[model samples]
Structure formats: structure tokens, C-alpha cells
Target: MYAYGIDLGTTYSCMARADQDGNIEIIKNIEGKNITPSVVEFISPTEIVVGETAKGDAILAPDNVVLYIKRSMGKQDENREHHGQTFTPEQISAFILKKLISDAEQMTGEKVSDVVITVPAYFGFDERQATENAGKIAGLNVLGIVNEPTAAAIAYGAQQKSKEDKVVLVYDLGGGTFDVTVAEIVGDKVTVVSTEGNHTLGGKDWDAELMSYFVAQFCEKTGVTADEIYEDGDVLNELILKTEDAKKELTSKNSSSFTLSMGRGKRAKLEVTVEKFDEITRHHLMSTLELTKIALKQAATKTSSKGKSCDQFDEIIFVGGSTRMRQVKEAMKKEFGVDPQVFEPDEAVARGAALLAHFLSTDQPQQTTGLGEGQSAADERFSEVTSKSYGVEAQIGNSMMLSHVILKNDAIPCSNTETYGTLAHNQRRVNIVVYESNIMEENTELSFGKRIADGQLDLPAGLPARSPIDVTFSLDRNGMLNITAVERFNGSKCNIIVKTEGLSESEVMTLQAQTSVIKVSDGA
Candidate 1:
């Protein structure tokens, strides 16, 4: 059995496997393409289609096709009903995974059961769990969930063969998400200092911005309401698709023009210059830069105790297919006052993931950040930070407040304990709900986060009002969570598995069986 490293991306996904000689090779899909489109379409009750074919079929069967499913991974109410069948995000993702693994098996002629998947560094606890569940639904053993930026760093280190200690600012702008991570590479170990990102922002947003611009321009020239054109599904889809092409065209050209024909033989033609495109989408790029600065500032704050600043890191490394845009590189140059390096933007993450997969499956000694007593320079260690805060909801006086236990950016494989007293006299049971929050303070209003798990803890009967209960939040290296609450007085304990709101075990099993019956078309 071979362990593969998979970059299950929002727009595209790729996989890599190490050969018997320890050389990592990128595995192409059945179509002989390095990256497969993350698109899935349901053609019949027992037929599923993925990759380029599905993406091409989306225009004709928009209602049956699903794209950008990564954006809905951990949402509480995210589900798609296609052809009278409701599919959760995890199930849609599982179909994608199945396509990846099936093609990989055929391509390599090797059994693939264990794999390491990469996710955005800023993904919350629930999101990470959802990814793991997707792997499980695909009947694969997930070795770990490595962050995309860290994986890219590992690939960069291996490619450059640099032995000196340095810090890298990784800007990962993928098809449907954007993130910035600051990491320090010391010897063979990579430690993440800080990470910031917007899961809803990425190349798709840029395409949408350009689409809106074209629609607005068309409306002005044709004297038609924007809603009138947008209400036409076929016309709108075609226009959006053309706008994406135009965006890609402007990447190298000074301008690109497109024409749209309305009824009554009326048509409108519009030309978009590179400068105008940049002007219209400058705010989006600015948002990414702001996040980059935030990550840098956080890294600086972390290093201030040791007399360092954000300037300690001078080079910016870009990853993801979207980084191929000229405007992105221009803005990065202006922001950093130096030319940024694009290190295998499209393949770095997958390669790094392959390296990690190889490391975990082999008997090679693991790397450590500590002084080397017996560790080799070739071995690599990984460390991650929490993307969101973990806390419990508390009712103080007449208002509800969030009592934070772990703050964001805290190192992983860590645990924190917080004690709280019961509110009512003679309280025998308390409901403990674990929530993932983005707020930093202990008694802050939480406007963001999701409820991961909720359970009841039993206390001694007739317990006094001020009796204390100990709650502990533990996060593993993969960012999966476990919450335990203990009644100190009676020594009673309750454990909650911190997972996302999605299919239960039985539901997942049922879905898995159903998917097994639905044959996926081969990539072409």
C-alpha cells in the first residue's frame, strides 16, 4: 500500500507519491493532467461525474452540478439538492476524493489506502474535522491534516536545499480561498508563527468582480437593467464564463474585449484594460495584503520578547494558481519593496504533502526543533497554531458571554484548563457546549464561530451554587479537538468529540454505501 499526499483544493486538486527509490512524483489524473478541476455533476441517480467533464457539463446542467464545495465544508446549513437528492458538502467532497484516488490507483497501479490531506491553515476546528470525515467517507485512512502553507514551506525547503535558518511569508491564494502564514524554518523543523485568511475570498471572487464589471458595462451600453440580464440563467452563466476567460487573458495582454448579443439582434461590445481590471479589483488584493500584514504583525509580536520585528522576514513566497496573475505579483512587490518568489505555486503544496506522507510512513527518524543529539538535517518536523479560539458559552447576569479557553495562534498539541462555577443552587446537571470563536478576550461578544459539540455533565445532587467544574480543551497537531468536563466535587467526567455539524456515523455509512453504488465517470 502506498501513502499519497493529496492537495484537496477548492479549485483544483493534485496528488503525489514517493517511489521505492524515495523520489516524489506527481500523479496525473486519467486525463494525463497534473491538476483536476474540483467540480462534480450528477448525471443520473446512479451516475456521478467529476473533473473537467463535470466542469464542462456545469453550464448545461447547472442545477445538477456542484462547484466550489470547499466554501461550504463546515457550514451548519450547507447542503445541495440535485435531481431531488440532497447532498451534504462532505458527500460532494467524498465524490471528489473518490475520483482522485480511483484515477491515482489506475495511474500508479498501486494500492492507495493511507493518505495525508492539506487544508487551509486558517480553517477552524470544525472545518478540519469535516475534511477528515470526507476522507473517511472515501474509505481512506487519513494520516494527518497538514496546513497548505506549511506544506508549501516544506516543499520550498526541499527544493532549495537551504540549511540556514530563515522566516518565510507564504501567501496562498487559491481558487476559492486566500491565506497568509508566517513561518520560521530552523534547521529541518518548520514552526508557524501566525496565520490569517478569508475562506470566502480567492480567484473566484476576482472572476466575479470582473463579471460584475462586464455586466455593468453591458447594461450601460444596451440600456437594459442588470437584473434583467442576470435573471437569464443561460446568458448569465455564459457571461460569467466569458468574464473568467477575459480575466485570464488580461493577465498577459494589455486589454481584452468581449461581445454579448441580446434579443432582437442587439449586441454590446466592451473592452477591459489591465489598469481598469486592477482598479476594480484593487480592494480585493488590498484585503489580502492587509491579512499578510496582520500575520506579519502577529509574528512580530511573538518575536518582540526576543528583540525582533516583522522585518526579520524579507522574502515573500507565493503559492496557488491564482498567483500567476501579474497584478498579484505587482501588488506584492509594492507592498514588500522586493520581488516575491513564486515557488512551484501550483505544485508546491502537493509535493510538500507527499514529503510529509513519506515521512510518516517510513522508519526515518523524525525532526525536532530542539538541539540535535541524534536528529539528521534531512528530517523535518512540523508545528501548527490554532486558527480559532475555543470556549464555552456563559450566562453572566442577564447577558450571555463567551468564556475563552484557548486563543487563536496558540501552538497546537496544547491543552488549557478553565474552571467555572455553577449558576443555580442545587444544580445537578450542566450543559457544556463547545464553540469555536474568533474573539480573543475571555468575556467578549462572539459574532463569529460555530458550535462544534454539546453534552451534559452530571454533578452531585443538591450541589451548592458556586460549585466548581473543570473544563479542558485539548488540540492535537492536526488541529482536531477534544473537550472534557469534570465535576470536581464528585469526580464525574464527560467527554465530547469536537466535530462539525454534519452526517452522523450511521448517516455517513449509509452515504458511503450509496456512493459505492453510484459509479463515477473516468476523467477524460
Candidate 2:
């Protein structure tokens, strides 16, 4: 009867739960470690391995290892063929989730069913949905998908003995994605102000920069072409593992070195100084700072009514294991005058999510009686804003335009409606194509955004042109989008829950069934 929280990260994952005393505790994996690597290895058609052991086996059997699968979530074409069977990103991710859940269940001697999973704040609809699907495939009840930064804020707010309201900025740079969020914490209630990020940016990118440098150096010393080195998957994977280790080392020491060996006695020892590492990957660090600036700007705009400036934050919090890099802290100090607080760089999200899961399952009231006056316990505890704008395609003048129905940064549990006229007489149906964009401008070119879902509303036959059709977009507290189209003339309506690019209901059920029988083991 324990509710848990999982931080299903890009390179590593962890699970946590609130104990009987209401203190959040990190649940150790079978290896007695707090975090597990998000790597999966398909050893056979019937057996799979996840975590540390799988990560180690990756260098030997590079083709069988799937790492950084978080980057491929919601991709329709990203799949691996093993033993004549196809495994999608969600399927691969399910193995990791299974490992986490199984390990937790074993250690706690209690069933772990209901859980809250954390994702990057800026993750789009498809990525979020795909994450939830992964949870379902793992045979767990996913209560909700909480944003990583928001979770961190909750953890931070809970730890504070002060009841003072504070505005906190969270910079989260994980293994495969980056997110910067600004939130206002009042006692026990956490309200997100603004969030910005790049789903493809993170610590792995830094590792890639170092790997490229290592490859170039090895080529110079061993007289081998880069393509030839890449063609040998084993050697490349070894380099990847070594490069990651070296990156972690550079975070603590001034320099780190690793030796890479290709066959035929071709071996080279490469060394990277911390300064050199920062120099090579400066752009990646700069990209995060740029996004942080955007997030701060957004926060300022949202809080301008209160006469608060972006720099007036009470504290700056850093989350994610990647934030352990020395360069990250130094950059934050140089950009903002305040010293940034690093709160459980690796475990804060899961810890906060554990607290949230407890609140959700028990419907606990707020501690300080701040915002939980009349609303449900969940609403009184947390609030978030939409990270992207949602719109429907419409014909305006001579060009097809995206008419935004919901603007970015709008508070969740919000709805908006727009009216459009039929394009042609006797139009049997009106096609509604929904689009999502990071851009905030209205009536932008359709190319500015990507299509998320589409549905059609049937109209009476022989309908004249310019008939009014109302399109409404509603976003729930969990960030799920639902669209409804109604014809004012006959009250004909079409309702669609925004379906993104991912597996269908039957597909998820099928994969769940297939995975239920497969044995998943933790790597030693």
C-alpha cells in the first residue's frame, strides 16, 4: 500500500517513496545503489538486462545495448529489431521501469503500484504521453507525470523551516535534456511561473564533444581515419563509456585520462584537462545559460504586476546530476549575482515526487493553509503552466496559418475557444488539424509548428460557405489537451483528446502482454 515516485532520467533512473514518518527516502536498487543507469541489454529473445550490468555489457555487445532511449521517446520510427522482434522506444524504456519497480518491491517487501513519474518541464505532448505509456507497459499505475523542476521545487519547499514565500529558479541539466523553470513557493503550495528548455540538450552532448576530441586525438596517434574508427562499433562504444567516465572525473579533478585500444596493438592514451573540457564544450554550457535567460525573462513578464524583477529571486536551485559539473556552477555565479543552491543534484526530483505521491494518494491538506482554502488537495498543493502554445490550422487570406487557441505559459486547467468559418459551400466535413509550437505569436505560418493531432467535424449536407464552427482547446492540470469542435448551426460536435505520435491503445496492450512474459534481470 505504498505510493512511489520515479525519476526516469536519460542516463540514470531512481525510485523513492515517503516512509510512515512522512519523510521522503530514496529506495535502493538490487545493487543497494540509490540510482540505476537507464541502460537495457537484450541478451536473448526471452531475457533482458537493465541498469549497471547492462551498461557494462554495452562495450562488448554494442549492438544489443540501448542507452539514451529517453531521447527517442515518441519517435514513430525509432525501433530496434532483436531476435526477429521489434522493440519501440516505449518498450525499451519499459525494461528500465520494470527494473526500478521490481528492485523497489523486493527491498520494501511491499507492492509498488501507484507512482508519479518526473519529466522535463518543457517536454511536449508526445514525449509526455510516451513516458506515461512506458509506465503503463511496466504494469504500474502512473498517477501523474510531474515536471522535474517542479518536483525539485516541492522538495526544496518542504525542506525549508521558513514559511516565507520565495521565488526560485531551477536549472535542470540531465543526461539527455535540459529545462529551466521559475516558480513561486508559498509555504506548502508550489506554483510554476515560467519554464523553458531544449529536449535534446544535456550532459550527453558534453560527453559527445569530449568523445569527438578523443577520436580526433586517437586518429592522430594511431594513423586511422575517423570513419574507420566509427565503423568498428565495439571500439566506438568503449570510447563512449570511457569518455563518460572521464567527464565525471573532470567534474572533481583538474584532469582525467583514459586509454582506448583498437586491435593490432593500436592503443592511445588521451588526457583532458578540466579547462580544456570546458573550452571544447563551451557552446553547450552557453546554450543552457541562454535558455535560463529566456526563462528569467518570462518570469519577469509574468510577475511584473507584482513589481518583481527577474533578479529578485529568493534563491536559485540546481537539479540533475549534470549540474555537478564545475563549469555549471561557475557559469551560474558569473551570470547571476547570487550563489546558486545545488539541492540533491541527482535525487531531488524523485524525492519531491515521493512527497507529491503521498499528498496525491492521501489527499493531504496544505501545511500552512496558504492556497488550499477551498480547492481539492491536489490543486492546493501544486500548479503548473503550459510550456508550449497549442493551435489549429486555419485558412487566413491566401495562406494556411496556425491560429493559436492556447498560448504558452497559460496556467493549466484552462480552456479557450475560437470560431472559424467553413472554407467552401457544401463542405461535408471540416478538418481540424491541431498544432503545437514554442512560438507565442498568433496566426503564424503553419511551418512554425508541428502537427500533434487531427480530427474532422461532420456538417449537414448542402451547408453554405462561411458557416460558423467553434473550436475549443482545453488543457487539464496534468497538461493533457482535449479539443472539441461544434457547429453552431446544428450543434454537431466532434471531441478529441489530443493524440500524439505514439503507440495506440491496442498497441500498448499488446506490448504490455508481450513484455509481461519476458524476464528482466539486473546486471551484476
Top candidate by lDDT = 2
- What would the per-residue lDDT of candidate 1 be over residues 1-524, giving only the tens digit for each residue? 66789999998999998654547799999999999999998988888899998887766777778889999987758888877787888888999999999999899898788888999988887688788888888888888898999899887766666566778899999998998998877766777888899888999999988888998899899888899888877677778678878988987899999899777665899789999999999999999999888888788767622346644685689999889889999998987887889988878899888878877776554343342564432234677788788898877667877778898889887899999888989898899977887666676664565677799998888888979899999998789888899988869899998656656777778878877888887535
- lDDT for each residue of candidate 2 in 408-502, tens digit (9 for 90 to 100): 88888899999999989999998899999998887898888989999989999888999999999999866789999999988999998876565
TM-score computed on alpha carbons, candidate 1: 0.93
Worst lDDT run of 10 residues, candidate 1, spans 369-378
Name model 1 segments beyond 4 Å from true: 19-22, 304-307, 363-380, 395-399
* Residue 213 Cα positional deviation in candidate 2, in Å, after optimal superposition: 0.6
Each model's backbone clash number? 0, 0
lDDT by candidate, in order shown: 0.83, 0.89
For all predicted structures, in order, the TM-scores are 0.93, 0.96
